[model samples]
Target: MTYALTNMRRVLRELRQERPADVPARLWRYAKPKLDVLGEEVLYRARLMGPLAARYRGPGIALMFHEIQSNVDDELRTGCSAGHLRQVIHAVRAAGRDIVTPDEALRRLGDRQSAPFALLTFDDAYADNRLNALPVLQELDVPMTLFVPTGMITREIDAWWLVLRAALRSRSEIALPPMERTFQCPDLASKTAALRQITAWVGTDQARAESLSETLGPLVSDPASLVARYAMDAKDLTQFAQHPLVTIGAHTKTHRFLSQLSDGEVLAEFTSNKNYLEALLGQPVEVLAYPYGTPGACGEREARLAREAGFKAAFTTRPGHLFPDHLKTPHLLPRIDIGYTPQRRSALFSRLSGFQRAMTTRWGAPVAVLD
Candidate 1:
């Protein structure tokens, strides 16, 4: 029932891109408090069954987080607050799971004698992670992997999503001739709707996306400063990389979706990002978390290219536990998103406990396999 409603919302969301005239209203109607209630109920049930669910000793879980801010309200909606981060850590530990590094988790992936554990990973190297998350993590003595998109560090480019959000915040409306639409951005809902529409189109064509963003620049008040406020500069990245508990990994150069590019383009994304990070940190970088990382954004080909570019492992946004089988296909590991609202802590735990993965797999969700 939860799965059906979730997929229904996903389908409605996709349909909204094509039929914006009606789907948005239906989506709002369908995706409101009722769906939230249903999700909460499901998580409640999963929590009740935690002990029984624990019996299926699968491989450890890799949890992915983006940003950790001092005050989550002031931060972008994409990230969780320091308080939430602590809660997640405490909850997982209380559930009898040890938090391990990616290296340790991978080493113990197929070892049945190994206790169930969780690996923490942060993507995009946001400065807030260093300021807020690092202290908390250090205090708790938890180690985490930080995936850096080298272009952002080098100031060669900004994340397009950040740029778009900043641009929308200052404007009431935006017109994109390429997309043949004018988006209303007078309120949060409209701004989010515009973001979804623009990102979907931009995710498909990199060149056109940049051109459109450039055209929309005047609408943004101080876009450059806005980006700098959120992203880590080269110096910040270098300093963070030297931290003993942080494992630096590649997250592509420009953060473009790999599946949209040609073979040469894909290879360049991995190799160049890897080379830049190695040169900066004075260490070999061996792991990758593909940007965008959805099925439409990354696939087996990108995973193979990541291997060819010399990465020991690659991760996707796919939600699952690290099974023994995943050891055979190291480059295509699955990770669960740990972003949570105040009410969804139980849901986050259900995902971390591997119960959600079991249910989804049993329901025939496609799991990636090595070629």
Candidate 2:
């Protein structure tokens, strides 16, 4: 669900039509609380485990991570802090469980699995992962997969979200052309409404790109020119991949929402990244993670593309544990999100006690089959 937020503009647009008057603040308030409550419940459940049992473990679990930076202040933007990453590693280690590599996990899975296992994964290839997260993983000798969007390898901050957030923060009454409307509000209200309306534009990749350029072009410091930045260069990736503890996967070329694209475009996005990563690593990159990893982000069609592209496995942002039945479709695996928020505790707990599966079946039924 949180992964789907890459398309914030699309969500806000829906809210605008449903509640034209007060969509932004209302949506923000409404959305985070539900997330928070779910988190709390998940954590409480996790803490209830009696003692770690090695033999009775269920299925192998994969945890998804985003940015992990030194100063925890900007943690909100990245979905996690260095402290959180450390804590998560510590928790998994203290439990005396094993941290399995993607290949090891799959091999064991092919053999009908052993005990419960875990694979730590990072998404959206951020520079901070090298500086903050990678060191921790290295020190602990943990195996992890870092999924990159390829486009961000030589780019600065994630350009799309930077623009979307700025537009949401602006109090200036601006007319959004694509929606064929101008938002009018006295103060923050208008800004929030604008955010709500604009989010809906993320329904399609082209719409997402255009809407971002339109809303953030004026606000971003230097929108006219493309700035060269390093998320993780070929050298960084090569060093990590050679570490024997790190694996790399393709996260598409442009980070566009896959569900919004046509079959041909989806194939291009999936295969291009796979080919790029394989070339960079000098190995067969058989795994893929959907951009955004949401129902609206990449649906059945996109899953087929990943399979057709010869990817052995594909991951989604849906929170839950993996079961043998889950192996039916290698292109659709359930991954638990380990975000920066305190709710991570909840998420971990939910996974341990099976609350995540329960909640996913109840509230997230659409993707239950995918899981």
User: Which lDDT tens digits does candidate 2 get at residues 30-99?
Assistant: 5885786665565476654323222223467778988676654222243567778878877766655578
TM-score of each: 0.84, 0.76
Question: Could you tell me which 10 consecutive residues in candidate 1 have the lowest summed lDDT?
Answer: 362-371
Return the lDDT, model 1, position 370.
28
Residue 35 lDDT, candidate 1, scale 0-100? 69
Which runs of model 1 end up more than 4 angstroms from their true locations? 1-29, 32-57, 193-208, 340-343, 358-362, 365-371
What's each prediction's clash count? 0, 13
lDDT of 1 by residue, 153-226 (tens): 87666566676777777778788887888776555555655666687777656676677668777677776776
Best by TM-score: 1
Q: Which stretches of candidate 2 lie over 4 Å from their true place?
A: 1-57, 94-96, 154-158, 165-206, 224-230, 342-344, 363-367
Cα displacement (angstroms), candidate 1, residue 79, comes to 1.2
lDDT comparing candidate 2 with the true structure:
0.67
Q: What is the lDDT of residue 200 in candidate 1?
A: 70
